[model samples]
Target: MGAARVTRRGFLLGGAALLALPGTALAATAPEIADCAAWGARPNSRVVNVVVQRPVKILVHHTATPNVTDLSRGAADALARGIQNFHMDRRGWLDSGQHFTISRGGFVLEGRHRSLEALRNGRKQVEGAHCTGQNLVSIGIENEGTYMDTEPTGVLWDRLREMCAYICGQYGIAPTEIYGHRDFKDTLCPGDVLYGMLPRLRGEVGGMLGQRLEGSSVRAASWPVLREDDRGPVVEAAQRLLRGAGRTEVAVDGTFSAAMAESVRVFQAEHATEEVNGIIGGESWPLLAAPVQAGDGGEAAEAVETLAATSSTRPPSRVGPEQWQQLLTAAR
Candidate 1:
């Protein structure tokens, strides 16, 4: 859905009024930010209300642009405009795809209109277009510069930490929810150099907030090798994913039972992987978690169909084409 647009004049006026109110000033504890009006963003053709659900995670992305040294407000504004133009005019999105953007010089700007306002109230989030499946559930932050080779500047990193800590505080989200863009998608965004620093980022954010880090709550981006008897939330996650992929018998009891193993074997064989062992390792995790759609053939489609059939009370033969389509859409 498209985002509703706020005129530049209205946005600035609103900002001024908000600033005049108590608790609206950009405090020392909060990162200084530039609203969409500050970046000269055009009004969106369509604006949607902020979704009231609290964000579950923070997804980080890199702009994939050159690491320009200009850290001035003008430069940051220009960069924001460029990104918005690309998303709106080129990508055909209603507004900026991300909720926020940070420049190389450490200037943070609101990406989508009303994003800053939402954060200020700590009430809701502007639905972003950054990540496909996670747009409604997570906050997307795009960092300036390509980080495939070199690391982000010290200033940029520090600002990112502050921003993350502030966001976590505002949303009541945990630091462990921080994730690289590549963690959810196939792209090399937020680049290797930056992505490798996520663990440290999470730790620093946690430290900044004076919160003790909890290992159990963190979601592992990569699946560690899991053989029979391995059990935890990760195992449960795998079971849920497999069940969604069509293993109806695999209960999400967090146990790697024989039935779960057999399901894994069948999945591996269907995918034509070299190893057909019931164990779920690196090879099986990605396939299991990857999205499936209608018209998709091979093992993945079969798995999805199997799950759909089992989820329904009706027999497999009785399930119609529209029902299957609905199942596929829901699975995604």
Candidate 2:
């Protein structure tokens, strides 16, 4: 109806300038500022004012339901600001509802300034609200979504994995600490399809943490090989994978046999990894094992081969300079 006040150039300038912050180096690359200026705005600007009353223990959230497709790098930043404005201006809240916000395009933005720093110290600090009661001890993360009955984009799922792992590691929060906003309240805020992936979300986060702990990147650690006598974890991993893939009917005995080796070969061929040799060597170790994801409601895990099929996104080898600036600038 009216001319959009924020210009793309303005967002670009804003995005470039954010790289100067102290925490930019540690955080992931942000979306383009120009992108942030274009997304649809939130309704009812009632800002809620509140105090950081307690230490954060977890992050919760719902999809804010902003309808748009073709989300550029900038939309993520725009969503963060819009949401912050909504919570502060519309909801009469002090700041954004969550400490982190993931855009539809998989961009992650910092809502509160001190959140990352506080999380790094693993000390008590106040995070924003997404879930009530738990808000006193949790960091809320609202994605640009309406999860009523829809599946989240692949990008959203990946970004959530990155954010969850980063926060959990920095704050000493476990995967069990991760929960959907509905888990605490009656509202199905995050929606069913997106929420249904919580178990996977937890696993992704756990997979991330395991990588950090194991001295590898997320992708690298997903399938790790045992160097020596650590065959127990590897053997167990292979058996589990074969069983999960429905290729072998092997018992959970911690021994590697020809049948297990054949299963591994089949899995390698399927994943397009090097053709599986009978020997489960270093190259084959990662394939045999499954990384742990945060379990949901105690359902038995789907098995290693199944996990390999599910965990498809690859980790970026190196962080680019321009992308880094975008992420820092998007932090509200």
TM-score of each: 0.61, 0.47
lDDT for model 1, on a 0 to 1 scale? 0.71
| lDDT at residue 170 of model 2 (Cα atoms) | 46
**What is the lDDT for 253 in model 2?**
63
- How would you encode candidate 1's per-residue C-alpha lDDT over 1-332 as one tens digit per residue? 12333332122232221111122223214667788887799898687559877788898999999999898889999999999999999989999999999999989899999888777656688899998778888889999999989999887898888788777766767789898876555456788789878888887777666655555333233434556887665566567778767887888687888888899999888887646878665456667755555566544445455455545533234324434333432332
CA shift at 326, candidate 2, in angstroms?
A: 44
Model 2, span 7-125: residue lDDT tens:
21121133221111122223322232222223433432343333434343454465556556968766666667767676777777765666666778877666655444344334446
Clashes of 2: 32
lDDT score, residue 64, model 2? 56
Regions of model 1 farther than 4 Å from truth: 1-28, 214-332
